[model samples]
Target: MSRKEDGTLVLNKTKIFDTENCYIYQRGGTESKYWQFYYWDSEGREGFRIRKSLRTKDFLIAQSLAQREYINIRAKIQNEESLQTLTVAEMTNIFLAKKKLDISSVPHAGITPETYRILKNRCEKLNNFLGKDTRVDHLKRSAFKEYEQWRKDGYGGKVPKTKTTIKTELSTFKSIIQDIAIKDKRVISNAPDIPKITIPPSEDEHRRNHFRHEELRVLIGTINEWKEEKTLRKTAGLHRQMIACAIELMLNSGIRVGAVRKIRWRDIRVNPKDNPKQQKIFRIITIPSENNKTGKQYECNCEIALIVEHLKRISRFNSPSDLLFCNQNDGKTFSSRIWADCWNEIIKRSGLEEESGRRFSYYSLRHTYATVSLANKVPLQLLASNMDTGTKYIQDHYYHHETEELTEELNPIKRTRKMTADEMLAQYLPQKI
Candidate 1:
């Protein structure tokens, strides 16, 4: 217990008047309430106070009420500080920007510009659906379900987006929010409770289709004819070569279009060990860590050395450092849109567009390669390695064959077991022989 110079009782330099803490002092020889609660806070080196009123005679009640109010105010301040005041749109931007940076640093993150574009478009749609003022904290589990139903009902145009597309979009959103929440400590915890968007059953039985040998021949001939006729305006010859190389490379090596685009001239190494006279030749194409989607380097055996030779022939005319397949106009790399346009044009000219509702693009070449390789009895592991993808994916998506090599290996022993039905029945049924 302590007291001030005015003889008022003080507890730790805080004057206690009638069981209430207050600051009392003498001015002009008259004792008066400062009308504030004052105290030398914990460290006791300095003093602080909250004022109630200058003329208040009841110091005790005023101090007690002031302390209670102080506590409540402090709590309100803390609550406000703890909350993050960002809108959903702002958070999404920050999240995606960080993601872009992360993906850029990775050797092969598989998150391409096209992927970003698609994600951005989907996020825009989500933003529009949820409304601009919607807060991140306000996003409920039911909102995602609603979004799914809305997409299913065709929010924009055409049929509702497929379940796979919806799933991907939702996954992107979830990843963004989760990442932001984890990085920013002040943010409210709302991510874990959000439900993942469910994927609907696929209507299409086949995820991919492979071109037949005849179809491939027809496509090649049509593309060649288009090039010869100079029907394409911007890149007649280059597009022709690109499509041809893309087809041949896929048919031979089974590499994806993205991987094909990333291939440099130096990545290819021809086999010098093989005898030149016997025509036994092979080429090795190294998919660098940066070019591969899985971030794993793959050494693929180039089955069609002639295709590599043709690429090499084209490389001689262009800059050695330039991309293998470059745009004809400025000798730069072809953009994704340009690539798509070229494929669309080829499909239109080939007349295969009417037969198959879905036109075969560069990716179709990859699918064709996988299917053809599986048909040729390529080992699953080997196919996986060549494609620079996982073995499980290869088996799941491409391989449909049911034959077992183990049965063939065990056939010789089975051939000798020619027991008749009576002998087999006797062996099963009889104990007395």
Candidate 2:
């Protein structure tokens, strides 16, 4: 079979439904095997056309599939629907690519990488429940309501999603459709409204997992021991040291992992008035807007200058431009896998996982900082400013720790000495007199 100038084979050309504009054929080159269908839509949009694979080799099956596609296209045109077709998964990929680029190029104006990670997870869940292949234009508002039910029904597991979790996921999914698919890409005509989820009062008060004082001691000790292992290779030992420094930095400064990864040596400044050896103002860490989760530049007085000094001594890439926490091999920031694996191993070795009865991740250090600060009577506004969050958030999430710290003060039992049972009974009987 000879190929046409457009690279399509003319040998397999067959007109469908005896129409001049519609036909089925095979292409040359890499697309030579599968049969394809083409429809010139003169009635819909000017010069509008559809070219898709029938995904079949047999002429009979190709003919059937092409006819079905042609009918569907014609019906969509008659109903004044969009001819552009994009699958849910394809739309999500496009949105995420643009989002990632925005985060890198305009970090202050865009969402944080941590927030992007959560959004990506929600999009994955949407893909799984609604199907990856489902067309964006074909989705109805009712599908989202069905999705709410599907999530409530244990999501095909023993534990169902909480109302708050479902609400957030649905809200994110809706925003992706409205902001990305419809408004940005113009793939879909309109966005479907997601059904509202009724979130009840949360039963679990302690949402943020944090390390106790003893657990922190054990964790730091474990990190120290892990880094000093005699069997560790040079590069491995250096990497563990970096991890140790990162953990201590977070515990001391309450900075997020995302922000910490972007830190450089130039961001640190020693207080001129205070001595580095014995000083109240040890060092100031300037978290730039681009690196911060809240996208605001702020300075924190931290006690991790010694840790930074140790890192500077060990690291070969200790230049001002190099990342503070980086891989020794490439002088790049540690990969997520490496950071997570090291954290998990440290937690296990510390015995904090079993002793604390909580799942501890890198973020737990931040929570621990908040709880400890609250316990130490750090003013709410000041702590919030230092942590790059609002006072209300701290009060809502971490106030329980403060209450525990003031247990005796908040509920004092006034008794000079232990009274006998008869004295207690006499006080109750003669209270009116």
Candidate 3:
């Protein structure tokens, strides 16, 4: 007999039958009431079945699934049938794959696999912090707050976690959970909102560690002395030359180290081509929009001519395909770690610390460049354009007005000689009286 012919089934009463070696059931009240379909093993054992609700009750929609389940139960033992289950690892992989696809299609895909790796590491740490058996449903906003506190307590020698980093990682985790919900509809039953992370204002403005002009002079002197020494002949003079060029370029152009390493011979060009003097002149280094971090072209001036000369010297020994500065061991582009090590060694030899009480690295050179340029009264807008960064960032980070200049500007009088205390007092008090 058909399920419609059966008496109306309310919340407690359900219409049930054994058919095709399986027990089938339909639960509903009257025609107006919602219905659901369920199935059990032919041997009357517990097995997988759809939940009773409006989603499964409509026979016109669920008849096919109901029939298929009955057929499967008859053909195979209920215990032998496989059921679908989604794991956290499986969900994470699926989420990352979808993220990759989305990033690839974007016009400016700032997200990279490295960024994904960092986010994944943070999630893994959070999972570990929650313990191994924690399920996706266990994640809540309060748990994230605890994680933030743990990070602030110094999880791994890093300073307190920045709100931006925390927000980004949590957003990635939220995306993964949403993906899981899409695949397994049951997961949508409980989804928690991600908490907002607060960023504290930075206390110290001068985070940049850079060399003073006098220290730079000493460093240059030390490099020149080392170049002239015969004992260091086996070492490639290329390191010294590269450091000199790097310092000069950073000081003059303010382009990042990544951009410097990627510069090509063709990118360096002079305008007014016909004039002999102008043709030889090194006026600008044009970084193509693709290689630049801002995805815009940058033009640096003749002050970078020193770097151009170094590039010309290096080019003679290598092809155009060769990087501007490369590791001798691997013949690959210079990595940041290697650059840092080189910087440390140079600083030690140059006695910069003893003289200035400050240790400067490659980035410091860039800061010094900007600071000196600002001190020279270079226009802010012009400097910003040359640096290929925002004018606001320059003003906020690099520009520091020298107090000496302000002092001189405010005081117009220049005393030729120091007056006696009595004379100074008389001059100051008696003029009006």
Candidate 4:
């Protein structure tokens, strides 16, 4: 037996080739008749041994297999490729496991549980589309070209998915490949190119379902009536008040429904000034990273201090740590079913849905806020920051063509002919009353 400087033990056992560091040998015992390929890799500071079964008893066949693998490994090392031989399924699993760890290790910068579920679903779709056994390194750019159509057709089902839904799913799929190949360095090759989905413009579609001012007034009126209804149980009344608070916060602050559901009393901060109006006018609301979809903590100015005061006056769970909108009996967040039922009832009673011919959800309040703010000429950058989104998104989704209300601004009188002196004087100067 001989030992190398790199700590590689050279056994004076069976050797098929005259290679110093790499060789093929067979171990004695009922370890079977299979030959083994052994290589001592000394590429890095710490050397390691690589061993694999050639799965053949014949010396020539084992020699051929060993040589081929050795050459391939050397070429990979030369190209600086990853040594991991992961399939699509294996890569997806690894990505998910890392994501799960990220949730605990870096909650502020990690994906939320809801986002995890969504990513898992997208990964399943990717696995189904491209066979799970497909090697990550072998993936080609052309493989994703038809994915949009395949996903849209609902995998040959009856109901086709919308382009918007397909676009989001494709984004998640692309992110998965990028995360594994580029970010994690798990693939031998660079990340494969994914085709982008071009979603057709759906201008004013978001605002169409949003509550108009008249509709909002009607909704508030319905809420006032429903919350104070005499037939409601004590716990039920508490729930309604919390729902009202949630609606007002979303309407005034443009906060997402999901983030609103997770708000705690301590998450809100009021101005320290003695002025009551100033305190109510300038409240800061913090959306925790775990509560929001983006997984990034941010604070936005909101005038919901008065509403918070009202909730504090009536809420059973008013402790700083308790959720502001929790169930009075158990201090738990309201279930999805409870929220949906209340919102549907509110819509049914408001009668705005019948008049407007559009359905409204909790998210409609946030949309309403954006639409109204844009109409009031709020700057795109300011509104985007308030909503924790991008200016381009606000411009694209909230820009409505219905500028009839702004006729004075959108289409001022254009003088094709010379204006009369009296007309010019009247337009330019204010007349004495």
lDDT of 4 by residue, 1-433 (tens): 5554656454434443466778876664344767778886666434546788889989888888988888887887788765556788987898898887766423457666657776777788888888899988877778788887786666723333346677777777777777885566545445666777666655225444677667788999999998888654888887888898889989989999988988998898975653776885668889988777677888878778789889989887888999989888999988877888999898898888678766678878887888888888888888899899888777776666555567766543742557678988888897689
Q: Could you give candidate 1's per-residue lDDT for residues 1-433 as a string of tens digits?
A: 5555766554323344333433442233245534545532221222223333434546565556556655654574466432235577777677667656654624555467777777677668767776756777666656665666677787733444356666666777677667774455335455634446555444344656567667788888877776566554645675667767866777678887878877777777766765674234567788877777777778887676777677667543345466677766666677877778778887788888577655467777887788778777788888887788778887667655535534764676757668778988988885975
Query: How well does each candidate superpose onto the true structure, as a TM-score?
Result: 0.63, 0.65, 0.58, 0.62
Instruction: Estimate every model's Cα lDDT from 0 to 1.
Output: 0.64, 0.79, 0.60, 0.77
**TM-score of model number 1:** 0.63
Q: What ordering of candidates by lDDT runs from best to worst?
A: 2, 4, 1, 3
Query: Which residue ranges in model 1 land beyond 4 Å of their true spot?
Result: 1-84, 105-114, 152-161, 181-188, 191-209, 212-237, 275-282, 309-319, 344-361, 379-385, 388-393, 402-433
Q: What shift in Å separates residue 99 of candidate 2 from its native position after superposition?
A: 2.6
Candidate 4: clashing pairs of residues: none
Q: Give the TM-score of candidate 4.
A: 0.62
Model 2 alpha-carbon drift over 4 Å, by segment: 1-84, 112-130, 137-167, 179-207, 229-232, 275-277, 348-359, 380-385, 388-393, 402-404, 407-433
Superior by TM-score: candidate 1 or candidate 4: 1
Q: Model 2 scores what on Cα lDDT?
A: 0.79
Off by over 4 Å in 4: 1-16, 24-36, 39-50, 53-85, 104-108, 133-142, 156-161, 178-196, 203-210, 214-244, 256-259, 268-306, 309-315, 327-364, 373-402, 407-433
Task: Pick the winner on lDDT between candidates 1 and 4.
Answer: 4
Clashing pairs in 2: none
Model 3 CA deviation exceeding 4 Å by range: 1-88, 99-107, 110-117, 120-124, 131-133, 152-198, 203-244, 270-283, 311-317, 329-331, 335-365, 390-393, 414-433
